[model samples]
Target: MPDLFLLNISASSIFDAASPEAASIRQLTFEFIIAASAVLLLVVILTSYITVKYRSKHRHEDPKQITGNRALEIWMVSVPLALVILFLFRSLATMNAILPDRGNHTPDIIITGHQWFWEASYPGTTVTTANEIHLPTGKRILMLLNAADVIHDWWVPALGPKMDMIPGMNNYLWLTINQPGIYDGACSEFCGQQHAWMRIRVIAQLQPDYERWLSEQTTNTHIPQDTMAKAGAILFLESTCSSCHRLKGTAAAGITGPDLTHFGSRQTMLTGMMANDSGNVARWLSDPQAVKPGAHMPRFIFAKDSIRALTAYLEQLK
Candidate 1:
């Protein structure tokens, strides 16, 4: 409800290239719709024609009774078979496109899933963050996924299918955004009470914007005028919250909770599970138990001044 941030988590055209998989999916959807419409139209037309044509004008004899039509039977089986094969072929081709090592592609970042949160690490790059993921538009990036706790699935509907993030196991998926925008993702598998809060955002930006973000994230860039954010940072460090969270350039370095570095800039909070805003952050901070009963994050009962200061500090993470 806070007016500071607006939510936009739909897919962008960055992943819109014509892959065999995507093409098949589109064709399959189209074919199904077309076939269903044709069948419905045929039924309607035949029903109306029969109702009028077969009117009982006089005393009629018994109507003809037919058990089956060989031609119709062949048509039904053959048509479905053909469509299924077409779909499979297209799907396989698409599957190849998404699999790792299929082409000369570079993964922009590595994403690891934790209980009710996500940790992102940029290997070989001095960059690490949580919840929100940023990628350059028009370039394909592979998400190397792993789980820290139980079974969890990462899915962004508009970008692609959901891939499971299981502990001791690794899964990967490729995503390419065609335009600059934010895409929403969720944990498809139910892991716990706060599973619903496990959300993610994929921010696709132009080359320059992405570079700027990368630069900012890599350095200790703090806004001097962001008094509120600074206060929030102080509160986060002073509270028991430090036992579970880690915010770069801050004294609170607890790996037990989600990373709070650049927390305000994310489109969604709680591993992309909740809306990213001052209200939700404050709400989460005030009573995490009520919002996510079994949440590992403890509620911070800050005094009035401290709460405002903490809120200001968090808002400055953008």
Candidate 2:
């Protein structure tokens, strides 16, 4: 494992780990810190003692010419090497224990990484959402991860292993959350220009809450009731935008971008980086390239009225 993946962390605060998997990582991190500190203290004390003991007592006399001790040489060489080996083995074992593998059985969720967004689909149901992911607590939720474009890495510091989502290949991660909370993460690998903004928000819920959320996601988006919003929905389906995004049970069946079936239910937009509000959505629709320089969504020249209507309609998706 590269040291690069070891420190991948992004969150509002240090949460009481939602899962034992995350706790194991915390344990390992503390172990690394303690081990490093002990070595540092030993080195400092030894250096200070050596300097004091060898200092010349008389003004004109030279200090004792001390030679290297065979025992000390052997101890120094063997001790560090032994410590290194022990840690190497310990980290590997911890990784195996938390990371999802064949022993984890099968994936309950299939997550695909696009240029700057995350699309998650539940295998057993018709639930697919972007950026914000939800999972039930107290269950071993296995995830099969892949990438649609360049390579990406899914890492949540509080959930344990950082797995790479490579194009044309599959990796895995599992989380058995112990409590209900909101955990945030990001695309650890640099996938593109907007890579830094490719954020991940995970909502771990109790089984009942998770079930309710899942049931909601599985439902098709309702027709807009407001006049402006209804018109906006029509425009959205007829425009070129429909060709890039997918809306469940709608004429918009494109698959090149994130799923928008449950867009209104999501708290954040632009791959979980910005708030999902009327202004943000309007700004994104009018000039996607301006807000996200490297985004694949091109600029759309919509009338101010159209922008407002569209924003209203999108906000009614939930």
Best by TM-score: 2
Worst 10 residues of 1 by lDDT: 12-21
Local distance difference test, candidate 1 = 0.71
Instruction: Please give, for residues 1-318, the per-residue lDDT of candidate 2 as tens digits.
Output: 212321333343334455788888888888989999999999999999998987777779665788889999999899999999999999999888887366738789999999999999998899989998998989988899999999999977677667899999988787797767777788999998999888888888899999999999999877899899999999999998799998899999889999998899887888766778888899989898888998999788999999999899999899
Per-residue lDDT of candidate 1, residues 113-178 (tens digit): 777887888766777888777888776677788899898888766566578999999777776766
Scanning candidate 2 in windows of ten residues, the lowest lDDT window is 1-10
Regions of model 2 farther than 4 Å from truth: 1-16, 49-67
How well does model 2 score by local distance difference test?
A: 0.85
Query: How close is each model in CA RMSD to the real structure?
Result: 4.3, 5.2
